[model samples]
Target: MSQGRTTEGVRDQRAELAEANHVLVDQGILDGFGHVSVRSAEDPDTFLLARNLAPGLVQPEDVQVFTLQGETDDPRKPYLERYIHSEIYRARPDVRAVVHSHSPAVIPFGVSTVPLRPILHMAGFLAPRVPVFEARDTLGSGSDLLVGTAASGAALAEVLGDAAVVLMRGHGFTSVATSIPEVVYRAVYTGVNARVQAEALRLGECTYLSDEEAAATVATNTPQIGRAWQYWRDRTA
Candidate 1:
C-alpha cells in the first residue's frame, strides 16, 4: 500500500518485518507483551505494526498500516501502545524502525537510578547514558504507566530525544534505529548490556566505554549488523 515502491519491494519489506518479530522473540527481547514497528516505505506519516497479538504469532498478513496518529482502517484490534510507535515516527525522521520490549534484565534499571550504559563493545549504541521516561511526571499520579495515549506517547518521544533507547519506569524500554535489523540488534544488546552491567556492579565499580570509544564502535558495528540479523533470522526458522 506504499507509494513509489514496487509491489515486490513492499512485499519483501513486509516479509522482513514479519521475520523481525520472530527474531526478536527468539532473541528474548519480546515475549507476549511487546511489539515492533517500521515506518512506511513511501509515507512517513504512516507506519506498519501488527494487530494486537503476540510477536511470535505475527505473520506478514497480520501487519497493518497505521497513521502517525495510530489510526488504522482494518477491523482487527491493534496494540494499545501503538501510539508509542506512531508518536516516535512523528518525532524522529531518522528512525525507520522501533522496538518496545519488557525484557526482564532491563526492568530493574528503569525503576532505579542505576543508568543503563554500554558495558561492552556490542552495546556501543547504548553509550552516553540511556534516558528514562517517567509516565507519572507527565501523566500525573495514580496513572497507569503505559504510554497508551497520544499525549503520553508524545511525552515519551520527547524524553527519547536523539537517544537510541529510552527506559520507561515500571514498564519497559523503547529502542529506535534506521532499519529493522539495526533496531533489533540494539534492542537485543541493550538487555545483554543491562545484564552484564548489573553483574559488574555487584563485583564493585564497573568500567564503561567512553563517548569516543562508543562512537567508534557504533560506526564499526553498523556495517556488520547483517551478520547478527542473519543468525537471529535463521534461528526463528
Candidate 2:
C-alpha cells in the first residue's frame, strides 16, 4: 500500500486521473456532467477529482484534492454530486476509485422495472443485482435526486453495500473498484451490458448468466481488465 507519494508520484496520479476522465468520455460512459475520482495515495483521507469541468477536458492542473469529508479549498467549484465519491470512499475502505456517470444506455434500467443483468461475460459483476437507489425514499419527493449532501450520499452508499455498481433512480449509476483503470473498465462495460440487455429484451426471452457462471467469469475476467484499460487509454491518447 506504499503510495510512493513523492512529487513525481503525485504528478503521475494526477495525469492518470486526467487520462481516465478523457477515456471515460471517449467510451461515451460520461458526458459533460459525470465525474471520476481516485483516493489519494498520499492521503487515504483525501481523493483527487477535477474541478467542475467536462470529463473530456479535464487537465492535470484541474485535478484538485479533497478530504473524504468532502472539504476542499480549490478556487474552482466542485461537482455538486461530489458527495457520491466522498461517502462511498468513507464507507468502503477497499474501494480506491469511483466513477459516477449519466451513461445514456444505463439510465433506463435505473428508472424502470427492467433490471440490468449480466448478459455477457465481460460484465459478470452485474450478476447478482444492480441495486437501485430511489432518492425519494431517502431525500423526499421534491428533492433534486442528486447525492448533494453527505446524508443522502451515505444513504446511496448503504444501498450500494458490497455491490460493484449501483443505479440511481431517475439519475444514473456509480461504479467502484480497487483501481482507476478497473473502475473505468467496469463503468464502460456496465453501459455496454445495459445496452445489450435492453436489445435482448426486445426480441424475446433472454438468458442471463447464472450466479455460478457469473462468479466464474468474474474471477477469470478480473485480471484481464488491463487490456481494455490499455485500449481505452490509447484511444484517449
Candidate 3:
C-alpha cells in the first residue's frame, strides 16, 4: 500500500478509535479494562493507544504513543495492557488494527473449553473454528493474560493463521482487521454469535454451516462491511 497514514490520518484514527471506545462502552463491549489500538498513521514503527482508562471517558488527547517493539518504557504515559496491541500489530502484518475487550456474552465462550464456532448467519464467516487459543486465563499468579513476549506474539500470529479473529481461552477476544470498523464489526458479530451459540447449545445439537458454506458466506458478505460501519457510526449519534 501507500503507507499513507499521515499525521492527520493517525490523528483521525486516534479520534475515531477514541470515539469507537465510547460507543463500544455504550454498547457494552468495553469498560475500563478493555482497549483498542491502531498502528500509527504517521509512524510505521509505532502505534497509538489510549492509556488505561474508561473507554467512554477518553478524549483525543488521551491517546498515547508506543514503540512497536515494546522495549522502551516511558513512564509519563502508558497503557496498562499495551502488549495486547503492540504484540498483535508487530506480529500480524495483515492486521492494521486490533480490539481487545471483555465483552459479556463473548467472555463465556472464552472460558469455555470448547471452541466458540459461529452458529448464526453473521458468524458464518467464522464457522467450524475461530482460532481459539487454548491457554488458561491465568498463567500462575498475576501474569497478564496475553501471548507474552514477541516470541509468543509470533506464535499467536502463526496460530491465528490467516483468520481475521482469535479468542484467548479463559480470557477475552482480539478482533483484528485492516480497519477500525472491520475490527469493531468483528467484535460485534462475535458477541452476537456467543448469544446464538448459547441458545443453540441449550436446545441440544444445533446445525452449523459446513466449511465450504462458511467460505462462500464470507465472500458473499463483503458488502455488509460498509453497512456495519455505517450502522455503528449511527448508533452513537
Q: What TM-score, over all chains together, does every model reach?
A: 0.97, 0.96, 0.85
- Deviation from truth (RMSD, Å), model 3: 3.2
Question: What are the RMSD figures for all models against the true structure?
Answer: 1.6, 1.7, 3.2
Off by more than 4 A, model 3: 1-5, 71-76, 136-155
The whole-model C-alpha lDDT of candidate 1 against the native structure comes to: 0.92
Predicted structure 1, TM vs. truth? 0.97
- Tens-digit lDDT string for candidate 3 (1-237): 344645567679778888778767766778776888878767667877887677888887788888877544545556555776777777777777888877778877766665688776677657657786655323444546665565555555656777777777657777887877777777778888888888888989877878888778777776678887777767776
Ordered by lDDT, highest first, the candidates read: 2, 1, 3
| Per-residue accuracy of model 1 over 1-237 as CA lDDT, tens digit each | 545455666677788889999999988999898999999886778898988999999999999999999999999999999999999999999999999999989999999988898989999998787999998898898887888899999999999999999999989999999999999999999999999999999999999999999999999999999999999999888
The TM-score, computed over Cα atoms with residue i paired to residue i, of candidate 3 is: 0.85
Summing lDDT over every window of 10 consecutive residues in candidate 3, give the lowest-scoring window. 134-143
lDDT of 2: 0.93
Task: List the candidate 2 regions with Cα displacement exceeding 4 Å.
Answer: 1-5
Q: Where does candidate 1 stray beyond 4 Å? A: 1-5
Q: Give every collision pair in model 1.
A: none
